[model samples]
Target: MIAKKILNDTFLIRNAKVEDAIQMEYVQSRCYPTLHESEILDRNHFANHIKVFPEGQIVVEKDGIIVASASSFRCDFPEHDSTFLEETDNLWITNVQIPNGDWMYGIDMGVLPEYRGLGLSKEMYKARNEVCAALGLKGQIIAGMTIGYGKVKDQMTIEEYCKKVMNNEIIDPTITPQRSAGFRWIRPLYNYINDPESGFGSILMYKPVDENYYL
Candidate 1:
């Protein structure tokens, strides 16, 4: 796909390259400071993701520097819920990708802290949706990070926090924007990752490429 310009040509969103792994790592580090090291995708993992599913990975560049990225892979809807590690095959998804799966599982998507508020994440999500449509997949599914939960964990239960976020009673740094991008919350996932900021909880969400999507 050709690079699409946005923000008055300040940013270009396009498919990711193996060479972008190092830069992607930089973005990842800056985007998820509270996340554990093991949970973060390393350079090797990024390279393997592009090799295994280039179409499912994309990056946003600014004058040739990658500032954001999203990684995904095709898979059938899971019969049982699983933690992020088990679901992502411990972040080495080479064996987790299904060649003809019905859904696009969004593994990671983040923009550099400095690039936040520019709507780069939304553009990345749109690109992923286009890939889903092109591949005739059902839609996209993700274990969304509740980046704002940690700060308020002492005041409310995970369920209460998520419910408030859903009802617009509160704004989550991650979930709020994802909701705006059209992802519907499916359920809550506990111990989703080693994320203290999220109180180790996450929300299962989905965005259908087609409005009439059904199981």
Candidate 2:
């Protein structure tokens, strides 16, 4: 949470403050046009962490402006959880799925284009894992974007676009580098690429917060 000491002007990693909402939204807008323009998770939604922790959450800042961020929490899969959280007064073992353990899901990760060549994205991811490790989070999961066909700027139709990108031919160019960074796809039963209402090709990428997942 308090990570400024480990990073500096070259890059500053720290927890989010409530007032950083506007700036966080600015960075989010520049990096994720479709998501931001659609107002899927606006600053107000991101700011809701204040309801739990008035300070908001964790943030990855560079030169005083936030480039990326991740919250310290995990989603509860209630239907899959057949637990006794309703009856148990304390958690004896967290492996049972009913709010069993804490994990930091990578809520959003992005960087402005100009700052990219500096390897900021990779560094941000590294920091994310570090934060997860510091808090003993179980793992990190990210909903990655899918951009198909030659190049998004040059692609004419969404069909052609999907074919090329989905086929692993021409990626977003940016997201393609994730392979080397130790991220792996968490396969889903359905055609992840064909689902549009849910946004095409969005898959869960997982990275173990600790070596435990490997064990």
Best candidate according to lDDT: 1
Estimate the TM-score of every prediction.
0.95, 0.65
Estimate the overall C-alpha local distance difference test score of candidate 1: 0.88
Q: Which residues of candidate 1, in runs, are more than 4 Å off?
A: none
For each of the candidates, give the backbone clash count.
Answer: 0, 2
Question: How well is each residue in 1-215 modelled by candidate 1, as lDDT tens digits?
Answer: 53688878889899989999999989888888888888999888999999998899999999899999999889998777888889988887889999999999999998888888988888888888998989998899988988899889999988799889878899998888898999988888878888898978888889999877644
Clashing pairs in 2: 148-165, 149-165
For model 2, what is the C-alpha lDDT against the true structure?
0.51
TM-score of 2: 0.65
| Each model's lDDT | 0.88, 0.51
